[model samples]
Target: MTAGNPTPDTTAEPAPGPESHPEIPWERLSARMVWINLVRLVISVVPGVLATAVLDTPTGPAWPLLVASAVGVSATALACLRFLSTRYRVTGERVERTTGLLVRKYRYVPRDRVRSVDSSARLRHRLAGVRVVHIGSGEARSSFKLDALTAATAEELRRELMPDAAGEPEEEAGRETLGPQPGPHEEVIARFRKPWVLYQMFSVWAVLVVTGPAFGLHWLLQPFGVDLLELVGELVDYERRGFWWSLALCLAVAYPLGFIGLALTFVMSHWDFTLVRTTAKGHPVLLTRRGLLSTRTVHRDETRVRGITFREPLLWRWLGLTRTSVITTGLRQGPDEDSAAGVLPRVRMWEAREVAARVLTGEPSPLEAPLRRHPRGALTRRLVWAACGPAVVTGVLFWLGRTDVLPDRAWLVGVGAWPVTLFAAVFSYLALGHALSGSYLVVRRGAVNRSTVALQHRAVIGWTLRQSIPQRLGRRVTVRIPTPAGERHYVLPDASTRQALAFIKGSTPQLAAQFIGEAESGGRRAAPPP
Candidate 1:
């Protein structure tokens, strides 16, 4: 048998027939999803009722509205219940998921093509003792929740699907030591907190929390025939109490109150935060966490990562924090309908560089390299000059506006145009500095994140040296490497003519020499075209 072929063990049972798969208990399986959906259905009906009330539309009978809401809720609940009753089976060779009430749908994932397995349990799911599992292939992925399965069974299923120990002994199945364990130096690489939760809470009560409800109530009363601003002006008359006294009181109370609300929001969203590294199914597992009310988990295949990037915003730098992300090959497209790409979320910021270096690069240099930009001063200066046109235009416009030479009506145009130019110049400078000071592509074989990539000089699909017209006039060039996936370009936008030619020729001799070598080898000599 071929190495990829599955071998049946003596303990294996007869493969289940198409119609005989075990039934999934609908109530047990999807209780949480159903409850959540029911709550959502009720919430959705409220908006409709509110719209009806706001418009004062010709009213249907109260009973009809109630009955319609009931029917809508019931239909949605039934659909979810039916979906949960689907049965799935995984054998040595393939995975089969079967679902339907009358006409069933079957999905098959062959064992060899299965790339990764992910499992997650939200708060609600944890209460129900269930976890959602996703099985991924390079081109497609599938997900299902196995309700109330024992943890042992979940681990068994993971092992069967992924089969990490292809040649190891069967007796080692239960042992954790079968795989390479992380040393003490290794640490948690990535983490996440639900920022949207904090954002939502802040949006709802920011005004009331920051300024006392008295102020909010006053603002709220404006639509109901109250003129609080005029009343306040009269009450705080300059003739009576001094203006400075009232202003001082407002500052003393309001500013600190605003900060208190912001602090509370941040704390609540990230309360009980925990990020840890552990071995699961003989692979490094990264577990991230946040508040007790909501939890999220992401699983990654360490071998699949192409690179890791650490980003530090100016604010984060001041706070000694760094956000880390990995560049992987494949992921599902989100609901917003972008092209299929990889998942890259902002992990925790504090003490991130050390953790990221240990997990992502196998050495600490990757994170440190980008932070040291002094070595590339010459390269950065040239790039800044090449990309500074936008910034110059922006500065000029700002100067004009400040001097009242540009009309206030055109303020937005000046506002929009200046930032783009300024940002471009800044980014160009940073990229050049990174290439010179921080540049090291440590290509290695069988590293967890950075693995060896095979490239044939003769198989150079395409190459280009490009420069903007202005850049060309300045004698600059940007080298582009085009592969099947897309193009990767590096802009050395301010090299001298001799330097540009030599750099291009040296870096991409394979592509440049391919045509020349082919012509000489084939004896296809010809006069230069006139």
Candidate 2:
């Protein structure tokens, strides 16, 4: 590799021999994949055994063994068929895979359009010497997978999909070169240690979402005549406990469960975290690699990047941690791949500034500037909007109480409901704010969890002035800044139109000029560009 380009060294490794090849060019998955699939077959087969037991069906040893044999034979045959059917190849321009024995299927992705390449292996897959390869495109929800491949093949595919570090092929005096020369190899900008990964895992309180699995299990068990609540109460004896004791018991049970889930998710998604910066066609490219069980590697051509987002959640902000995401075109169609695209999954706030300065070269730093706060009317609007739901509920309750449809104590519901509603209203209102500083636009929003996005002005594709009746009455307008990256829309929920316009004009004058001068014209009349 040339200056500033550093290739990963694997020189000591031996190459795969012809004996390992199934064909001249195409490749098949590791034999261990068959064993892995057999295990999966066992897992799927267990439910039937359990169902038989639950139904109190009389079963002989021979009958159960027969069932097992039938399922095993079918699963083993299917696994063999799939292994035989699947094949892949990597060439100069494209990577392709073919699968299915009877109903054949084929998929090919051009090397240039490849946005991300990742590999993952669960416990069985790891033991079987195979990994699942995940390939993503720039379009939303466009992803493909190779069910199983050896580690060597996965690496080879990754190299094939990525542009060469040496730069694209160049013309000699007389003839064309070996291949398009690759851009300079990327340099490591940052890498997270185990401690940092731990911090990031703790930063997200996914434990709070643990109720999803618990409740799902509870509902599923209900059909089997099991009262999940009674079972749990029997174990913990919550009825006999005092308020504080119950609280302590719940916390004791919840915290560890939450930690395990969070830790697993963090490790699976962010193992061996590394970030790299390199140049392609003279523009920067950001690459990320991480994942414990399922490794993911993603690359972004900085030339296609429109801006960046700096996110700080409440708990994370207190720990001085932030995540940095990129905004780019051709990214609007994905199914929330922000986690995959995060350049800084977990970095200190100061580190974010440093990385931003490096990655967003020549652009203004929005973090250094003070954000402009929305007018009081914005807060009032949120409060009113939030209050409507509670007010309607309270009204319904009062009417029901007078008509004897509900108990006289129904009025008491508002005592708790009103306070919670007000809190949400006030919190949500307080969370809304926006700022425009030079070539950057910073938006602050979110009620329970706070998010602050700092974006460059050039990324603002169009300006939308949205006003509801209440917003109009309050002399406020919602400004939406749409970009092609991810699902997030940078919005200033309730700001003065004057401030919004001024901010847009300052950040992207071209877009503002068109919006102001031509946007106001009658639909029938075409307004030329300024």
- RMSD of every candidate to native, in Å, equals 12.0, 10.5
TM-score of each prediction: 0.50, 0.70
Give residue 245's error in model 1 in angstroms: 18
Query: Residue-wise lDDT of candidate 2 within 235-293, one digit each (tens)?
Result: 77777886688777876777777877766776777767777775555656576666655
Best by lDDT: 2
User: What is the C-alpha local distance difference test score of each model?
Assistant: 0.45, 0.65
Model 2 residue 113 CA deviation in Å: 4.4
Best by TM-score: 2
lDDT of prediction 2: 0.65
Predicted structure 1: lDDT: 0.45
Q: Which stretches of candidate 1 lie over 4 Å from their true place?
A: 1-87, 91-109, 138-156, 164-306, 313-321, 328-350, 360-364, 370-412, 436-439, 442-530
Please report the TM-score between candidate 2 and the true structure: 0.70
Q: What is the lDDT of residue 72 in candidate 2?
A: 70
